[model samples]
Target: MIENYIATHLIDVAALAILCYLIYSNNILNQNRKWPFYIGIMLTVLIISSEAGTIIAGNANGDLRFLNIFCNVFGFAMSPLIPIILLAIYDVNILLTNKLLMLPSIVNMFATALSPWLGFVFYIDVNNHYERGNLFIVFVTAYILNLIILFISTVRTGQKHHYPIKAKFTALSLFVIAGTSIQLIFPSVYSSWHSVTLSLLLYYLLLSEFDGSFDALTRLHNRAAYDKMVNRLDGRKLYSVIVMDINNFKEINDTFGHDFGDTVLKKVASVIRKSFDNSSTCYRVGGDEFYIISSETDPVKLEHQLKCMTNNLEKERKNDGRLPTVSYGYSIFKGGKGIGFQEVLKEADDQMYYFKKIQQDMKKSTQTS
Candidate 1:
């Protein structure tokens, strides 16, 4: 038992040190008011301190009732904060900058504070061991609700912004649920905080990859990310390639200025993101060029999706009335180069040129005017 406590404490201490170093050294922690990162750090510290309390109580042969209560209180208070902090990290406006989101956490903390008298969360015995109270399930229920909200909010936010948020949030929620459930079932096992720390490390790695792979201006996958995807497609997965170009883009830039050109690009990227499903990835492969690689190679679905994008672009043109429009063409792999990825790209490029020519011939590009 003593050896287990020592190991858990050492791991928690090392994780906290690494996390502090990462926050200080990395700029991600500084962005978006840094509230998310601050909350994460605070949560980690609270867990670590709680673990310390546990160790102390154990060392005292459960004689330190105060220490045991302190540990349980900290743990209880962390339940509501976890979801709020995650929402903040994902730039949920209502949660991050406003005190409204803090209310739940504050309430939980207050209730946990009254645990000694009310026995609402947990109780410490004269021997200093901890046990759940009558209303202990209330806190557990709150945690479950928090996780569900986090999952739903993350999915909605991702869809609204065309971001792949599900990967990050899903993994995080699952880890927390699994870790905390195990700890709740077997309190003496003492593995919850360590599991959470491990999850944090994994999330950091994922965030780094996400930050590195996406374009800063347009928020689409960058050319480097495109190359990475191409490398991964070793002919095992069937794919269809869609290539797009903003018509009269150079003229739009020269006439409206670079800032306006940037807005146009953002608008087009937004359209592309909204038009495509999660099965496809959009990449900013060039200044005015984007490539959408769809895993679904079914000809009918590809055609339908392509037509939807075309109709969407037409609607966008109608809305803006004067801004330049985008032209796109897609090609399903037809076999060449022993695999045909490049063949599909070349065919898509050809089709894009064909599509652009037709558009120019039809409308004469309302852009220059």
Candidate 2:
């Protein structure tokens, strides 16, 4: 009976660990440096060890085997430490520069190494069956304590960062800790269903984090996220702004339909992405309009770049046999004009419409000639 129970828990734990690792891996691939992958790696290892211990404890008879005992001791002991490392990673301020956040991982490793001295936790006979002793309390208690500490840390870090997903993360952490504790204390609840529950929570958190800063259609920072970043920038830094509007975009939409109009917008967004450096912020402010902000750009160089881009866009339009044109207006802040951000943006907009009118008039005269 005990054998069947441990086997079930083993499978469930393994699945949860794998799901967690996938989430961590996805974040790393997306260039998110705040989440450390090592924490997931360690959790996976600990889960595997615990699963093995469960198998030994259930199947073996007579005495608890050394491997079985060691796995149980380390597995339960190591679980809580995983989230502490994760908390450190989530707190970007400390993780970005402060180095002391690495202590939990190091300390957990030492604890894992010393676990074998508890003979009562695991004893073995020739049949390889394992027997548990009274000191299982020590292993269980250590695991519980770690979970509590990590839970508190995660909550604190989430609040400090003002992460939108903070409540979700906090609730998931609490649920997992509660579920694990219940399973340990009341072995009857240890089942695959519990694992599924934990896995679902992790999956939701991962999805939230993945979509946190991006717009699904344009792959640019969403307005909400962009505002957050803008609020964080130093006021003294000079950031040049470029606002561009597609000429007669409404006519294009009316003629070709909304789908094709969307395609054009995407094409323009891609052009901006390719032209600007990684530091620039590009946003689609409205239908047929985009804003590009770049820091510390040289005015002359920026103007040359804008001209070159216009020429290239014209070439593209000719190749496509399309009549649409893109016009841009930008301003470089020399830091002493006493101009607010919105004021500079207004000036740029006026210039854009003025130039756009000139282009329209030139086209009309050419047709008349």
lDDT to native, each model = 0.75, 0.61
Predicted candidate 2 versus true structure: per-residue lDDT over 106-161, tens digit per residue = 45455545545544434444566544445556555555555555556655644333
* TM-score, predicted candidate 1 vs. hidden true structure: 0.72
Candidate 1 lDDT over residue span 156-191, tens digit each = 866553456687778777888898889789877777
Candidate 2 backbone collisions, by pair: 60-129, 60-130, 61-129, 63-123, 63-131, 64-123, 64-124, 64-131, 65-123
Q: Where's the lowest-lDDT run of ten residues in candidate 2?
A: 28-37
Write down the RMSD of candidate 2 (Cα, Å).
10.2
